[model samples]
Target: MHRQIAGKLTGPVTKWIVLVGAIVLVGIMAPLNGKLIDVQNNEASSWLPQSAESTKVVEQLTGTVDPNDIPTLLVYHRDSGLTTADLAAMDEDAKEIEQIKGVTAQGAFSPNEAKALIASGAKVPPLLSDDDKVAFVAFTFNFGKNGWQDIPDAADKVRELSKIDGVDVHLAGFGGQASDASEAFEGIDTNLIFITLLVVIVILLFTYRSPVLWVLPIISAGFSYMISGGVVYLLAKYADLTVNGQSQSILGILVIGAGTDYALLLIARYREELRRHEDRHEAMAFALHRAAPAILASAATVVIGMLCLVFADLNSTAGLGPVLAVGVGVTFLIMVT
Candidate 1:
C-alpha cells in the first residue's frame, strides 16, 4: 500500500504540495505557541520567591551570604560614630535606588525617632560588627525575582556610594549573584541564538537548493514551534511548571532541531518517491506512509529522553521536563498530520 502511493507523483507537483502543507501547519501553530510561553513566564515569575522583602532580608542577615543577593540588614552604630555627612550620603543612596523598577519598597537605617523602639532595650549594638569593621546598612529593597534584574548595576552603584573612605562595606545576599550571571551572559546568548539561526538557514538552503523545497522545512517547523508552545503554556497552567529565561533557549533548540528533522525525513521520502514514480498524489501518500514510522519512533525516543529529565533534582528543570516533553510530542503529531 505504501509503495503504491509512491508510484503516483511525477516531479514538480510533488514538491509543491509538500511545500504548501508545511506552511499550513506552521500557520496553525504560531499564535497558540506565543500565548503559551507568555503565560508560562508570567506564572513562574509570580509564584515562587513569594515574599520578596523577607527574602531580601533573609539574604542580608546570614553569615557568609553571597553579596550578589538582596538582604535586609539591621545596620546600626553609635550616633556619634556616624558623621552627619555620612548620614546624608546614606539617604541619597536610598533615594537613587528608588528610581529603579521592580523595587516594591525601600527604606534605610535611621534611629527610631519613636521613643518606644529606643526604649525597647533590644540593644541596638553600636559599632554593629566586630572591631568596628563591618556593619549592615539597614534598608531593605522592595524587590522580587524580577527586581533582581536590576540588581547588578544597582549593586555596583550602591557600592560606589556605600563605602566612603574609612567605612568598610560588605554586601552579602542571595538574589544578586544570579542576576549578575544573567546580565553577564546576556550578550553571549543573543549572539549564539542569532548565529545558530543563520547556520540553520544556510544549511537548509544548501541541502535543498530550491527555494520551494527549503520552504517545506521552514513552514513545517514553524507550525511545530507554535503548537509546541501551546502545549507548554497549557501544562504550565495545569501542572507545576517553571519557565525561566532558559525556557527560550530550550524551546528554540527543540523547535529548530526537531522541526527540521521531521521535515527532512518526510521530504527525503517524498523526493525519493518523486524520483521513483510519476504521479503526485501517489508520491505524497508513499512519502507520508514511509516517513510516518520513523518520525514516530524518533519522536517517541525524544519523549522518553525528556521524561528522564522529570526526575532531575532541580525543581525548575523537573517542572520544565514534562512541559518540554509534551511540546515535542505535540510537534511530532503535527508533523505526521
Candidate 2:
C-alpha cells in the first residue's frame, strides 16, 4: 500500500509537482525565521504557574503596585573609602542616568538619611558595605508594557554614563537581568542556525561519504527548521502561545537533528534500492515504501511525547509542546516527501 502511494507520488511528472510545491512552501516560510523571537514571552510571570504564591503575588502587584515601574539597582564600588569627590561624582552619575530615555533614576540615600535611620535604630539597606568599599544607586522605570524591551538600551546608557575615574559601576536587579538576557539572545536566530547547520553538514559529510548527498539532507533540514519557525511564530502571534528563548532555540536543534535522522535513513534505503533498480524514481519509491513506517513511527512517538507537555503547569513547558511538535512534524513531512 505504501509502495503504491510512493510510486504515484514519486512518478516522473509527480516529482516535479512535489519539487515546485516544496520550493513554494520554503520560499513563503524563509522570511519568518527572523520573526520567531518577536512573539517570545520572556517575562517571568508568563512562565510561573498561576496557583503559585509568587505568581499570585506578581498578579496582585501587576496593577496595584509598581504597575508600570521596573526596579533597577546600580552598584558602585572602590577599594578605598569613597572620597568627597567620589560622592559628588556618584550624585552626578545618578543625575545623568535620570536623563536616559525610558528610565527614571533615583538619587542614592543621602548622609542625612543614613544618620536618621541609624538614630531610629533601623537597619538601613547596606548600600555601603561594612568595609565602605561599596555603595549603590536604586531607581525605577515606568516604561509600561514595553519596559522590558527598553531594559537593554537603558542599561547600556546607564553603564556608559555612570563611569567614574576610580569607581566601578554595575547594573543589577531585574533590568540588569533583562539586559543580560537580551545580550544572550542578540544573534540567536543566525548563530544557532549557522552552528547547527555547520555541525550537521560535518556529520552528514562523514556519514554519506558523498559531497552531493550531504547537501540534500542539509537543505531539507534547513527547510524543516524554517517551516517550524514560521508555524511556531504564527501560533505564538495569533493563538497567544507562549514562546521563549529556550523553547525557540531547542526547536531549531530538534528540527535539524530529527530531519537529518529521517533523511539519513531514507537516503540509505534509497541507495540500497538504487543498486537493485535502474530508475531513480523507482528506487526512491521502494525506499520510501520500506523506510517510511519506521520513520513515521519514530516521529509520531516524539511528536506525541512532546505534545504531552501541554499538560504542564508551567507556561514554558506547555509552550514547548506545540513548538517542538511542530518542529518534528515539519521535519517528518519534509523528509518523507
Candidate 3:
C-alpha cells in the first residue's frame, strides 16, 4: 500500500503536479500566518477555568468594576526632602495623566487632593511618605479587552509627563507589570522564528556536512511553519481555539523540530536506496515507501500526546495541546509531500 502510494506520488506527471499544488497552497496560507498574533487571548482570566472562584468573581464584578481596569502607581522618590516645587509638578503630572485617553479620572488623587483629604479626615492613605522623601499617584486605566497592548505607551506617556528635577519616577502595580510584559512579548514571534531557523540551520549543516544539502530540510520546515500558523490562526479566529504567546512560540519550534526529523529519516532512506537503484526517481519512491510507516507512526504519537492536553483543566494547557498537535501534524504532511 505504501509502495503504491509512493509510486503514484513520485511518478513523472504526478511529481510536478504535487510540487505546483504545494506551492499554491503555501501562497494562500502566507497571509493567514501573518495574522495569527491578532487573535491571541493573553488576559489572566483566559488561563483560568470558567468554574474557578477567581473566574467567577471576575464575572460577577464585570459590570460593577471595569474588567479592563488596570490599577497603576506612579512612584517618585528623592534622596532629599521633596520641595514645594516637586509637589506642584506631581500635581500637574496627575492632571495630565487623567487627560490620557484610557486613564480614568475617578479616584485618581493628585498630591494636593490627597493632602486635602488627609486634612479633612476622610481616611485616605497619605500619598507622601513619613520622611517626606517619597510619594505616589494612584489611578486606574481601561484600554478595553486588549489593554495590555496599550499599557507600554500609556506608561511612557506618564513618564514623559511626570518628569521632575532631582526626582526619580517609577511605574508600579499591575499596569506597570503589564507594560513590561507587553514589551517583552512585542517581538517574540520574530525573534523565536529567527533563532529557531538559525539553530536548525547550524545543526543541519553540522549533521549533513554538506552546505547545500541542509537547505531542503530548512525550506520544508519553513513551509510547515507557515501552514501550521495559518491553520492555527483560523482555529483561534473561528473555532474559539486559545493561542497565547507561549503556544504561538512553541508552535514554531515544534514544526521546525518535527519537520527536520522527518526530513532526515527520508533522506537517510533515500541515500541508502540510491546506492541500490540506478534511477533517482525509483530510489526516491523506494525511500518514501520504506520511510512512510516510521514517519507516520512518529507523527501520530506526537499528535495523540498533544491532543491529550485537551483534558487539562487550565485553558492555557488545554489550548497548548491542540496548537502543538496542529503544528506537528502540518509538519508531517509537508515533509512527507
Candidate 4:
C-alpha cells in the first residue's frame, strides 16, 4: 500500500502538479505575514480565565467604559526636587496632552493646585511623592476597536509630549510596557527566520556533504513555516484563538525544527533505497514505504501532546495548543510531499 502510494506521488506528472500548486499557495499566503501582528491581542484579560475576579471586573467594565483605553503614567523627577517652575511646566504639559487626539488627561498638579489643597487642609494630591523628588501625571488613551496595533503609536506621542527640560521623564504603566514590547518584537520575526534558515543551511550542508542536496530540506522547511503561519492566522482571526507575541514567535521555530527532523529522516531512507534500486522512482517508493510509518508516528505524538494543552485554564496556553499542532502537522505534510 505504501509503495504504491509513494510510486504515484513520485511520478513525473504528480511531481510537477504538486510543485505548481505549492508555488501558487505560497504566493497567496505570503501577504498574511504582516497581518499576523495586527490580529494579535495583548490585553491581560484575554489571557486570564473567565472565572478570575479581575477578568470578571474587566468584563463588567467593558460595557460601561472605553475598555480599550490604556493608562499611561508620566513620572518626572529631579534630584533637587521640583521647583515651582517645574510644577507649572508639568501642568502645561498635561494640558497639551489633552489636545492630542485619543488622550483622556487626568491628575495634573501645578504648584498653585498643590498650595490650594494644602491651604484647604485637604490631603495633598497623590501625584507628589513623600520626598517631593518625583511627581506623576496620568492619562488614558483610547485605541478604538482592535486597538493593540495602535499602542506603539500612542506611546510614542505620549513620550514625545511628556518631555520637559530640567526634569527626567519616564513612562510607566500598560501603555509604556506595550511600547517597549513593540520595539522589542519589531524585526524579531524577520531576524528569527533568517537565523533559522542560516542554521538549517549550515547543518544540512554538513549532513548532506553535497551543495545541491542541502537545498531540499531548507526549501521544504521554509514552505512549512509559511503554510503554518497562514493557518494559525486564520484560526486566530475566526476561532477566537488567543495568540500573543510569545506564541507567534514559537510557531516559526516549531515548524522549522520539526520539518527539518522529518526531512532528514526521509532523505536518509531515500539515499539508502537509491543504492539498492536501479530506478529512482522505485527507490523513492521503497524509501517512503520504509520511512513514512516512523515519521507519521513521531508527528502524531507531537500533535497529540500539543493539542492536550486545550484543557488548560489559561487562554494563551489553550491557544498555543492548536497553533503549534497546526505547525507540526503542516511540517509533516511538507516534508513527506
Q: Sorted by TM-score, highest first, which candidate order results?
A: 3, 4, 2, 1
Decreasing lDDT order of the candidates: 3, 2, 4, 1
lDDT of each: 0.59, 0.82, 0.89, 0.80
What's the true lDDT of residue 175 in model 4?
72
Q: How close is candidate 1 to the true structure, as a TM-score?
A: 0.66
**Candidates 2 and 3, the one with greater TM-score:** 3
lDDT of 2 by residue, 83-142 (tens): 667766766776777777876544345333454578899987645567777777777766
Reference-based TM-score of each model: 0.66, 0.87, 0.92, 0.89
* Model 4 alpha-carbon drift over 4 Å, by segment: 99-101, 104-126, 145-147
Once all C-alphas are superposed, what RMSD does model 3 give against the true structure? Answer: 2.2
lDDT of 1 by residue, 103-184 (tens): 3354444332222345776555432333433344444444443443555665666566555555445444443444456567
- Give per-candidate clash totals: 16, 0, 0, 0
Clashing residue pairs, candidate 3? Answer: none
lDDT of 1 at 103: 35
Using TM-score as the yardstick, the better of models 1 and 3 is 3
Model 1, residue 12: what's the lDDT?
51
The alpha-carbon deviation from the true structure for residue 256 of candidate 1, after best TM-score superposition, in angstroms, is 0.8
How far in Å is the alpha carbon of 15 misplaced in model 2?
1.8
lDDT accuracy of residue 301 in candidate 4: 100
Per-residue lDDT of model 3, residues 1-337, tens digit only: 2888998888888988988988888898889998887788888877998678998898899889888889999998999888888888888888888988888758467667898988998988888998989898999988886686778898899888888889999999888898899998988878988898899899899889998999999988998888889999999999999989889998988898899999999999999999999988888999999998999999999999999999988989899999999999989888887
| Model number with the top lDDT | 3
